[model samples]
Target: MQAFLQQLPALIGVVIGALASFAATSAAERSRWRRTQSVRWDERRLTAYAEYASAVKKVISLSVRIAAHRGIHPDIDALPPEEGLPALAAAEEERTVKWETVLLLGTGSTVVAARAWHESAFRLQRIASGREVELSWSEAIDAVSKARRRFYEAAKADIGIALGDVPESYDWQISRLIAADSTPPERNT
Candidate 1:
């Protein structure tokens, strides 16, 4: 009985050590799981952001081509409305579908920026469709560019990318001016 009593402290110490080890392991595993989930969510958000941007850009590209056909963007190659309108519609549909994913995965500010970007793109579409006459093509393009920059900024921040300001490109204006000096190709409707 004396021997057992003497060994009780050692047994108690062993049990306590095992419990501490288990607790530490459990905490580490939980942290790892959380980190994994965070990474997975980040990846999904990035994909959503990229897909939404691609879809929007596709719509904008189609609109620009159609606008070129209407003599609005001389720098771009004209795509007659017959050919361009259908393509633009398809691109818009794609954008709409991708937008759902963005809504599901994007952060609040990112989603707002995305919405602004797409709305600017819709303005371009309206101009190309001859539904908006008040806004100049150049102004619409500028608005889209600015909105796109904002969306990219929001997305980068959401994804923890701390890069500085996104550089603005004036290449479009330069190209437009250069093209304006020359005659545009005749667009057959």
Candidate 2:
């Protein structure tokens, strides 16, 4: 009986050690779970941002093509405005659906940037639709460029990406439009 009593302290120490070990393991698991969740949300946000950007670009590209066809852009090779109308309608429809997803998944700043970009795109669309306001290629392209820069900045900030990651010459699409509009299209046999 005396020996058992003497061993009670050892038993209590063992129990306390087991409890501490369990607590430590539980805390580690919780931390790991939180980290996983954070990574998942980050991936989701990136996908959402990228998809929204792509969709917006599609609409802008179609608008550019339509404008070029209407002789609003300097491109001589573009298909006529009538030929691009169906594709433009399709792109607009896709943009509407993708914008809904952006609204659901985007942060506040992202949404704001997206709205600005979309508005800028709509300006080009209005010009393509023959608003008769004499919108110039430079003016339309400039607005889209500014809005796109804002969106890229907002998206990068949201994802913890440094602003420096964006290249200085970022408007590849707009540049392509300008260059295409300036040059005459090759004749097809």
TM-score of each: 0.85, 0.80
lDDT of 2 at 27: 100
Superposed by TM-score, candidate 2 places the C-alpha of residue 130 at a distance from the truth, in angstroms, of 1.0
RMSD of each: 3.3, 4.1
Mind giving the per-residue lDDT tens digits that candidate 1 earns over 104-135? 99989999999999999999999888795666
lDDT by residue (1-189, candidate 2, tens digit) is 999999999999999999999999999999999999988888998988888889888888777767766666755546566777787778888888888877887889989999999988888887876765455666777788989999989988988888885455677766776666565444431
Query: TM-score of the candidate numbered 1?
Result: 0.85
- For model 1, the superposed segments whose C-alpha errors exceed 4 Å read 169-189
Instruction: Measure candidate 2: CA RMSD.
Output: 4.1
Model 1 is weakest, by summed lDDT over 10 consecutive residues, at: 170-179
Q: How high is the lDDT of residue 54 in model 2?
A: 91
> What would you estimate as the lDDT of candidate 2?
0.80
